[model samples]
Target: MAMAVQGSRHSDFFVEGEVYCDTCRAGFVTNVTTAIQGARVRLECRHYMSASGSVERSAEGTTDATGHYRMELVEVDNRGAELVCAVALLSSPVPECHEMEVGRDRAPVTLVQDVGLATMVRRANPLGFLQTMLARYADTDTRYVDTKMRHL
Candidate 1:
């Protein structure tokens, strides 16, 4: 879920990241976690060029068989402007692992090149999804029900 934002030679930007399922329900990737193929991811950005107005940009991508996706933003000139971007989970192919992690669902990224980065690549923190929570009812019949609405 780590997003790597790269600036190409033509000023086009690339938003790259991987999607994974938290099999251990730990809210983070573990050794036994598996990649989520066909998962959807989105990149949203807002550029504040001046105090008068701002511009919004967005792009979507789907994860491949290896759970990797790269979205392209063409002709994005964010230099000398305040750019705020974030990558978020859109959907998961696995039904059991469709629960979005509370705080790790969206990852903030820096797209500007004024941060003293040695290269044109800027990396953001990891984002992930957790397995659906299940709970057994207190009644005699033992059946697990989805606890999606229940705050953990």
Candidate 2:
């Protein structure tokens, strides 16, 4: 007869990677010529999209001390599906500065199609970036950019 072994529930979590600056072509990390210190970042994910411009359930997350964030929306019990990475920016209001600082800009989100569940290994709790920063934005008067910076 097979004996039952006690175990704890395990969840699949993925580390949200850091964002890169297009102008600098460098990692959005804060300092040390790599990851920035006191820099802010976020992760947004959505199910696959079709040609009709429709969307499905999506989740978001944030980075931690090691510049990695985690998200655990997908479950092995839930049918296997793909997800994508959306948005990378110079985050604001880091722990030292819980509020947005002057001269710092929030980068526009750049969605990547291939960031699915397959690329990562599931961990009980991911390290690096925090699961989410929950940083508040636009508390003050700030207008959304009407155009891209590529030309400027």
Candidate 3:
């Protein structure tokens, strides 16, 4: 006797994320950080062996006032091959925060799955850029002095 198993199928997947400016240059998004408006973001999918050697499919959307973006990707059948997908930052309107950070530029996400589900929504981590230094900004003082040494 042999047994067979069945799994659920999904027709599409959605990727959602946010973009922000690292005010303190903390390298990550924080509550104090502000959302970047009019920022460009893109979702790219690439296959290993393509004659064109370009992105197979791509979709772009700009950030809103709240710096939130959502992209819907159609389920692609790669015929047993892996399909690479990632959400990357393209540009920022704010000149002060236009520099892209090292690891925060692009975030890889899984778009294809065989598990049983009607629809899958993946939430990507926040991507951010370092803000330019201001003329009058300064770090807090951390120096300490010994009172006894002063008396000596």
Best-fitting candidate, measured by lDDT?
Answer: 3
Give the candidates in order of TM-score, highest first.
Answer: 3, 1, 2
User: Is candidate 1 or 2 superior in lDDT?
Assistant: 1
- Evaluated at residue 57, the lDDT of candidate 3 is 72
What's model 2's overall lDDT? 0.35
RMSD of 1: 7.1
Q: What is the C-alpha lDDT of each candidate?
A: 0.70, 0.35, 0.75
The superposed Cα distance between candidate 3 and the true structure at residue 141, in angstroms, equals 14
Worst 10 residues of 2 by lDDT: 124-133
- Candidate 3: lDDT of 109? 70
Task: State every prediction's TM-score relative to the real structure.
Answer: 0.72, 0.36, 0.72
Model 3 misplaced regions, further than 4 Å: 1-10, 48-53, 78-81, 115-118, 135-152
Please give, for residues 34-125, the per-residue lDDT of candidate 2 as tens digits: 23334444444444554543434334555545445444444332322444434334453334223332323232222322345444443222
**Residue pairs in steric clash, candidate 3?**
8-116
- Model 1 accuracy (lDDT, Cα): 0.70
Order by lDDT, highest first? 3, 1, 2
Tens digits of lDDT, candidate 3, 43-86? 88777677676887777878899989888776556431466778
